[model samples]
Target chain A: MQAKRVTFPNKVLPYLLLAPQLAVTAVFFLWPAGEALLGALYAEDAFGLSRQFVGLENFAALARDPAYLEAVGVTFLFSGAVAGLSLALGLLLALAAEKAGRLAGLYRTLLIWPYAVAPAVAAILFWFMFDPNVGVAARALRGLGVTWNHFLDGRQALLLVVLAAAWKQVSYNLLFFYAGLRAIPRPLIEAAALDGAGPVRRFTAIVFPLLAPTTVFLVVVNVTYAFFDTFGIIHATTGGGPGRATTTLVYKVFKDGFEGLDLGSSSAQSVVLLAIVAALTVLQFRHIERKVQY
Target chain B: MARRDGMVERDGALTLAAHGVLILGVAVMVLPVYLAFVASTHPGADFLGGRIGVLPGPDGPANYAALVGLGAPPPGVPPIGPMLWNSFVMALGIAVGKIAISLLSAFAVSYFRFPFRVTAFWLIFITLMLPVEVRILPTYKVVADLALLNTPGGLILPLIASATATFLFRQVFMTIPDEMTEAARMDGAGPMRFFWHILLPLSRTNIAALFVILFIYGWNQYLWPLMVTTEASHATIVTSIQRLAATANQEAPVWHLVMGTAILALLPPVAVILAMQRLFVDGLTETEK
Candidate 1:
């Protein structure tokens, strides 16, 4: 809502500047979103020839559909696992890098480059490593007396996708966690040390609590990444699994609409996903504002 | 003296522990890539018959050359040379396009007032959340209906309307002293003149940083390109690599070339990140903030 006190008086230039962004948003984002909302209200014949106005029918059908429910459950499980795993691993890596002293920069660079790898590529790399026949890691695991076949087993397939997704995300979380660590005043840690507290004690009493804001922010981001961005991993590696085991909600939307040609249900799912993203964005914005005020 | 010695010993032990953990972390981070690179160097079908050799092979040059079409085309796989070009074009377009539009829009929102000004900002802001994956079907329908399918504009335009870039630029512009603008106006400089001369140069670092992030993002895109292109000629390295993997599974499983393509798919973005490491980190943290 704020603008420059000594602002330009040219009323026309601002509109011109806003036009391109507005046009793209309207055509690409807003219009499609509107169509999704509208399409969700109607069910079309599979042949795409006829349609009937069926208010809330798609929603009801989604509710009744066991596969949809499974997808939702799987999505939540996948996201929660990703968020938790990435955050914990990231925090650990960040803490280690902070303590790494002369090697910190090298460690940081090495650790963060994975953020640049494509999710699909990351999945492929992992798939190769875990390939039942030739995968060295899989062979290693088998040597330890465990069977590893993602193509045949649904849980293994889900786990594979989760790891692939979480692996790509760890770098993002690590960067944030490391930044948060750096932002913490060193004097607090020194003071704790002077009070005879150990490193773990200092972290628990002083550092971890101060990281609350960063943790919250990363939680939303990591969840969003897992929920939406990992579509590449699922699409490339598992294709929603040996039996839909790895099909997150976003994946289901693509599968249903594009592959299944069930436009109505897919649009309804998109609406649901949109609502979720909006809610997360609102939460993130509120937190950001609060952080700024702080 | 004894207490000092004890404190020194404890610090040394802690630092050593830290180094140990970091080394392990780095290994985990680098292991897959290292393995993939190793796998790419092996002769064809090596993954099928034996434990994948952990070390590099003699065929690295031939495999990579084959991947790029310098050698014979790997059987059952398309050359990644043009796919990489498509990816490069898309990435550059999205990055440049997003920055150009976002800079203008952020300038307008920050420096001027107009009807629907807040509404426009909010509208663009909403797009930060509505990524293409969520609205795939309808968005695809929009693209198809417009007959923009398989076109570079189709791949680039829809994605360039970014909230993060707009917000980043707006934040940077707000930090510029109001006096700068006032002084420019006092000199009878027009709005375009002020923006071109003052704001553009001042925000160079922000733009550069954002360019790095957006380029990586655009290059790594999979789902949208997969949906839009549908033509092999338009395929990005990322999507094509996946297709190669799928095909590999269905038939002979061209492990060597597929691994090579995977390596190629990741090379540009990783190179970009490493080359602009500081800016990438700054851009990421700042934009997220």
Candidate 2:
């Protein structure tokens, strides 16, 4: 909120500059969010003929709805898996790259471009790779005496979507993790080494502890990513699945609203999602606040 | 002498292990695209023949040709040419629109004192938490009511109203020394003039870095464009790639050409990342900071 020491006195010019952004926020972000909250309280007839105010009916129905519950469970499982796998792999790769000497830059380039690939496109690449009939990976799995068909098997479908989502995210995690590693002071590592500690001991005692802040930041980011960004992966590959097996909460919102034409329930779900995001944002900001204090 | 030799041996082994792991990581990341590219080059029957070949084949040119409009339109899917154009336009619009509005707003909030400025900043900050996915229903309704369906403006505008770029620019502007502004004012420069001449040039790298990020964000949009653009003409390459995969020729789902389109869909954004690696990395780390 701090302004320049020598500031501009023209109020009208400031308002003019702020107008476009304010207008867009009001119409697109603020208005839709308000509507979602308001619309969640009402129920409309399926035929678009009638409407009635049902204060918490939508919420109650969502509670009882088995599919909604399933979607919630799946979202937790998917996000936990994506965040855990991506973070671990990213940390490993970052450590390796740090020790890789001259080849580090090449590996970084090869590893990072996937972050730019669309999640939908990433899903397609994996979809083709694991397709039952023509997919080489599928054939390889079959050769090892395992059945592989996401199109028919729900668990397989969930695994496919998880892998694709995690694959797309690994690049992002690697960048942050590597940057975090680079920020660690070198003398500490050398001192630990001079104490006769091996590489693993050095990492556990020194590097890992130092990377804690970065790891925490990446955790919040990865969870938010797995929760929202994987909509593309689900939509492109599984379409929420052979039987809603891979349907995360965000996917369920789109399906229920757009595909099912159940607007009231969808809006209620939207409100629920908005609340979750607001909570996550608060968490991230709290971390930022702490960082600033330091 | 023995201790020195042992230390040298350990260093050599450690370096070798590091190289091994990094290479494996790179391979894991790249192998899927490599296989997809190989699949793109092979004949359709080769994929359907069970167990795809691992190397490039003779069909690359033909498959790409059919995709980019040298051949008949594949059944139920449009050619990739128009869709690519649409994606380009939408991405460009989003990058430019976001930069223009965000730069102005950041300038306003950081440089001028005004009523409700903190409230405005907080309002924009709130949008950071609510992605378009969470509020799809009502937002779609708003777009439909505005008759923006099947139009590029609808696809570009709502998504561009992001606080990420605005917050990024604000952070950049804060780090700029106030002496620059004071000097400009003493030189008889107006606020807009200073912004146009001094501030704009100074933030060129930030702008370029942001452009790379926003362009990718816009180009890779799936759900919003999927909801809004129903017409084939307005279809983006990312959305259209989904359509292509979902509606492949009934019997076998033409894996060859679908892979080709997939490659096309990924190329531009990947090229941007590779071309501007330094700026992209700086922008990414800076924004998150």
Best candidate according to lDDT: 1
Report lDDT (CA) for all predictions: 0.90, 0.88
Q: Across residues A90-144, which tens digit of lDDT does each residue of candidate 2 receive?
A: 9989988887766788899989999999999999999988988778898899989
Report the C-alpha lDDT of model 1 over A1-294, residue by residue, as the tens digit.
688777999889999999999999999999999999999999997899998899999999999999999999999999999899989999998988887766788888888999999999999999989988788889999999999999999999988988888888889999999999989877677767878898888889989999999999999998989988999999999999899899989999999999999989999999999999999999899889989987
lDDT for model 2: 0.88
Candidate 2 chain B: worst 10 consecutive residues by lDDT?
B1-10
Which pairs of residues collide in candidate 1? none
lDDT of 1 by residue, B83-140 (tens): 9999999999999999999999999999998888999999998898788987788888
What lDDT tens digits, residue by residue, belong to model 2 across residues B1-289?
Answer: 4322233224778878888888888888998899989988887777655646688999899889888888665555578888999999999999999999999999999999999999989888889877999899889888999999988889987887868888888888888898998899899999999999988998999999999998998899999999999887899999877767765524655788888999999999999999999999989988886
TM-score of each candidate structure, all chains considered together: 0.97, 0.97
